[model samples]
Target: MRALTAAAIGLAAALALVLAMTAVGAPSGETSPEPLLTTVPKHP
Candidate 1:
């Protein structure tokens, strides 16, 4: 039971770290270039 609790806590901590890094590393909308998909021509 203790091991299970520790594993769950570790998983939660890792998830939090990943989320924090993504939030910090992501580019702001104003400075970001347009997505490539938008520039591609659509075939009808």
Candidate 2:
């Protein structure tokens, strides 16, 4: 159906926009911090 196709296209476009924004805002090179998970103490 045309409606379903349109919805899928809109969703894809929104997702791409979000990804682009995230990429643009993200830190690059040496300034990036180590991932938080690595800093957490592991349980025995």
Candidate 3:
């Protein structure tokens, strides 16, 4: 029981740390560039 409780706490702490770091970090909401689905032939 003790081990399980400790493991849960550790997991929660790691998650919280990641959340906190992201909260104060750079904006990660930048839109991804549209995928180039097709390639065009190059002219010589």
What is the Cα-based lDDT of residue 14 in candidate 1?
A: 100
- Which residue pairs come into collision in candidate 3? none
Alpha-carbon lDDT, every model: 0.87, 0.88, 0.91
Q: Give lDDT tens digits, candidate 1, residues 1-44.
A: 99999999999999999999988897656754855565668799
lDDT tens readout by residue for model 3, 1-44? 99999999999999999999888998658776988649887889
- Minimal lDDT window, size 10, model 3: 28-37
What would the TM-scores of all predictions be? 0.56, 0.57, 0.56
User: Candidate 1, TM-score vs. the true structure?
Assistant: 0.56
User: In each prediction, how many residue pairs overlap at the backbone (N, C-alpha, C within less than 3 A)?
Assistant: 0, 0, 0
Error of 2 at 16 (Å): 0.2
lDDT of 3 at 37: 48
Best lDDT among the predictions, by candidate number: 3
Which pairs in model 1 have colliding backbones? Answer: none
Regions more than 4 Å wrong, model 1:
26-44
For model 2, how does the per-residue alpha-carbon lDDT over 1-44 read when each residue is reduced to its tens digit?
99999999999999999999998896666854755565668789
lDDT against true structure, model 3: 0.91
